[model samples]
Target: MLTFDIENFPGYPQGIGGPEMMVQLREQAERFGLEVHDKNVEKVDVSNRPFSKSGLKEKNISLRP
Candidate 1:
């Protein structure tokens, strides 16, 4: 599990704890069917390959090195 210290975020006058903030964020994202992964993406290839939905050039991506 990844943890973050969110003392700098707004709405917490006294600064919210790290674990608590992570839990709240995770729950909110879950409500929208978002899946969070803990793996580190070590590499990315951004070479021009295809056009995106907006008709702009985009790159094919590969996460692993």
Candidate 2:
């Protein structure tokens, strides 16, 4: 939900709309086996190997690719 346009993002040549670009990026991530969460992250811990994520929508999310 960005309120403006993006002018410097790669591969766009001219430019891209913020919301449209966000959707495209999300789709691209999903194609690569990413579990996309459209919720706010409440907590995160990256001191260990397998990272930790905590939030109201979900918890114990793995940051490993």
Candidate 3:
């Protein structure tokens, strides 16, 4: 994804690169307490509340619906 360029992104009138946009988006999301991961999700256990999510680097997680 970082190997390409964006010519007309909304915030950057001139445009932004893929990697730059990724970093910008991450920083913005982290400011609101969101965790970012680059690994593929192997499993998800939503059968119970306050989850026992699997295959992620951060194994301890709580998810609610």
Best by TM-score: 2
TM-score of each: 0.46, 0.76, 0.61
lDDT of 3 by residue, 40-63 (tens): 666778788766556656565555
Which 10 consecutive positions of candidate 3 have the poorest summed lDDT?
56-65
Candidate 1, residues 19-46: lDDT per residue as tens digits? 8887888999889877665544444444
**Tens-digit lDDT track of model 2 for 2-54:** 55788897899999899998899899989988887678888878898688788
Strongest candidate by lDDT: 2
lDDT accuracy of residue 58 in candidate 3 = 55
**How should the candidates be ordered by TM-score, best one leading?**
2, 3, 1
* lDDT of model 2 at position 1: 66
C-alpha-based local distance difference test score of model 1:
0.57
After best superposition, candidate 2 residue 46: deviation in angstroms?
1.0
